[model samples]
Target: MFEGLSHLARDAKAWPFEQARNLLARTLRIRLTDAERDLAVVLINSGKTAEAVATFPALAKPVILETGYGPSGLPHLGTFQEVARTTMVRAAFRSLTDDAVPTRLISFSDDMDGLRKIAPNLPNQAMLAEDMGKPLTVVRDPFGTHESFGAHNNARLQAFLDNFGFDYEFVSSTDCYRGGVFDKTLLVALERFDAIQKVMLPTLGEERRATYSPFLPISPKTGRVLQVPTLERHVDKGTIVFEDEDGTLTEVPVTGGHVKMQWKPDWALRWTALGIDYEMSGKDLIDSVKASNQICKALGGVPPEGFNYELFLDEQGQKISKTKGNGLTMDEWLTFGTPESLAYYIFQSPKSAKRLHRDVVPKAADEYLQQLDAYQRQEPAQQINNPVWHIHGGRPPQEGSPVSFSLLLNLVSAADAQDKAVLWGFLSRYIPGASPETHPLLDTLAGYAVAYYEDQIKPNKAFRAPDEKERAAMLDLRARLAAMPSDCQDAELIQNEVYSAGNDAGFDPLRSWFQALYEVLLGQSQGPRFGSFAAIFGLPRTLALMDEKLGG
Candidate 1:
């Protein structure tokens, strides 16, 4: 699809932005599937009236979409995916409702969670080792940037979210506990301890069940949040008797910040206390979510509606882990791709398992650019179906030049461009009168391509030594390119030359010829169409590159 568009641009002697837009309009359009429509109806009946109206507009309440985060490690791409996906759903809600309907996104951090194990990525690991089993709120910040380790990670999470312009209320579990915000909920959990245990204990193994207690008291002597057995539960006084680290029995109030419940009970209590309208979790947590919902029902509150999204995997298909440090980081992605591209990655078939790695960056970036181009020229109905419209909160930015990420990467390689200025110099030759200000998206892509090439492409790039027949074909192809008119329709001319070269080499044009070109030029068996690349790279430069590869 993009190759044909590039050919039109070369033939027309212009960018053919309109034709690109029309092509996207015809191909990239989307509509609500039956399941989606049913989900929209469910939202309407569940008092997300505004979301229903926005999604369907003829239909119409204030809604809360909650996403949870663990502050044990630096926020990664998985964290961003949850927020981005929730934001898209919120956008769908807006599309279905009148402007007056209120929606709030809550980015809740579980900073009160106990540091069961030290994170491998943090500095001053020895210091963290001494604080294991303590609440994250009390662990010293290794970087010395915040009051505690949790506080430092929370700040990082908020900073990344701010970079993306997300409007969200940040809630810290430590603050919620310390400020007595969970006091009532904590009391409710203590009174319903036996009932909540029944909902949770069936899911635990015998070994785990032996040590399980809904309430975990913070040890005053050791400062560690102890998960030991509760000796006595005084529901009347709202206190629990448990042994401290020193083996001395102590009576502590469960309310007013002395204790916190185990995660399953705590999750349900949070839903009951916060009245969360919607939430999401990974598929691995399905059983936990179900147990929490049951506990929520025991507490006389309904669990929020939500979906379980599949977890992300590394390129090797192994689960992405904060401890393993085995997947792409948020900063790495932002360095090489636009935030919208990351958002689009999250938006695409979120329920299915997807790989998050460096190699996926270019494809996502180009898809985002395609959506942006399509959104610009599409009619209102079609625009509604474009993911970019929802990604941009229904007000997508104006279209810029239709430069794809792969093309920019190739341009960086072909011109040996180190920066945007060098790239723009080469780009202006083909685009004619274009400037950075005139095409900000392409300009940004050029910078990203340079970074990506340096970090990802350059290190592993290896050119193959062509065989005798392939070497002769490349040399002849270079001669033909040199003979072509400088101002000719480069895409068509180069395509014909490549076909003729295949005939001369006695190779099949459909397969071996193009495969040979890719292996010889890009060191890959498949790549961006050579005809389109030649046109964009310019005939003279393409000839020079071919000659360089042919050792002539």
Candidate 2:
């Protein structure tokens, strides 16, 4: 019993890494290997030994970091995924740490790299050189350039940062390394230059050089790799050697390695140099990240912590890429909804899993608002450590009337009580004999409606008023509806009454009335029956809307 008490006490003091399995399952939806679990334990208390552990208590911890985006073309959903993932992980780290310690996030933009032709459909394809070996930031086209392509990519990147509210320090390789931020690491690598050369380039059959070509020339036409001449090494002032055809050896002047450190060594080197703690990269870089681990051991540093997230798939299941031209840009999504909705879409999915297309956004929006509302409504909890809820059962935090753009527009133009149904009437005008209760893209349609009223309706009053012929048609339709039986209750009854009234009034111009209503209500050519819409929007408001159309 005494031993049991001691054992229980010991177990009670176990590290937070013990919770790693549960946390991974709940947060990441991933399972960890035994090795991964063990490493996480060490990682949780990294740099602290058993001695430190005994002397002071600490929580399980992991430094968080992420691969920064490259300043390239408009960032597609995939690039935005990285931003969202990093932001959420930072949030997670804070949650785990009880919001005591600040989490660090690093962003790297490969701006000094040359531009290679990508995405066949990208505009100004000719501007990109056919060389993959060049740094995107280094290459320039014939046009003197409006803004550097690198700068343009940075602008797009900033859009995501602002949209998602990410907290990170941006790093540009051209600037950071050149500014000597990595000078120590570069010098350390130079000291082991011979070791890297042997591994980077080896004799055939002696060993397989795990690294690919490091000094390849960039093909300007095909953007493929081509071995190029060497330059003087700017960092070490040493020269490198190369083997030519027929096994002849030629001494190339020491220049920078012909190619940038292949992604593997570069990954290891950058992490070691910068002491980066974590990086989330694309799935395509999985192999490189693994290879980088091996190189990190060779370079005398631990590999940086990291995770690999999968790419976003389009509706077609193909990877979402800016190059594909099919992926939705951030700008387009923002037009339909707020930024929080976008982040909600990303955070709700596992980073390594693809998100299928679904019409779940409106619900997500409602849910976010609902969560906010619930948070506001909550009284202080008796439990001091209860977890804050991220969402509240997928409902809007607040309530809103199920009003449509057509209603708003009609109200905006209505001159009196008769104009009360003006908006609904205008909206119903867009429907056939029947209108859709829910629009597939109601938000966008609403935006168009608002814009039309603000920019066109108010400014083009003279153009909105129907001439004498249109006035006669509307009056005729109104008279027809008035003559309908008092018992007429259904939509069909109203329609028949308006048609008959039009003929009786000798204005047999129901179609003309519709066209005029469409033009006045939506600034379009044809629309729903004005008479039926006016009945619902209220006859007074409809007529008042007409009055304002002519006079206001």
TM-score of each: 0.85, 0.53
lDDT of 2 by residue, 201-253 (tens): 54325334433344443333333333543332334453344444334444432
Give me candidate 1's TM-score against the actual structure: 0.85
C-alpha lDDT score of every prediction, in listed order = 0.76, 0.49
lDDT of 2: 0.49
Query: What lDDT is obtained when candidate 1 is compared to the true structure?
Result: 0.76
> Which 10-residue window in model 2 sums to the lowest lDDT?
1-10
Model 1 lDDT per residue over 1-552, tens place:
111122222222111122222221221122235666677646644545445556754222345678999998877777888887777666554443323345688999999889987756679999999989888989999999899999999999999789889878999888888788888888888899899889878898999998789998998888889989989999899999998889899999987668987898888878887767678789999999999999998987767767788988899999988668787877889999888888888877767899899999999988888888878788665665677866777678887455678878877776767787888876787787788888887888888999998888777777787899888888888888878886554676678888888788899556787888877776656556677778877787777677777773
For model 2 the local lDDT of residue 497 reads: 60
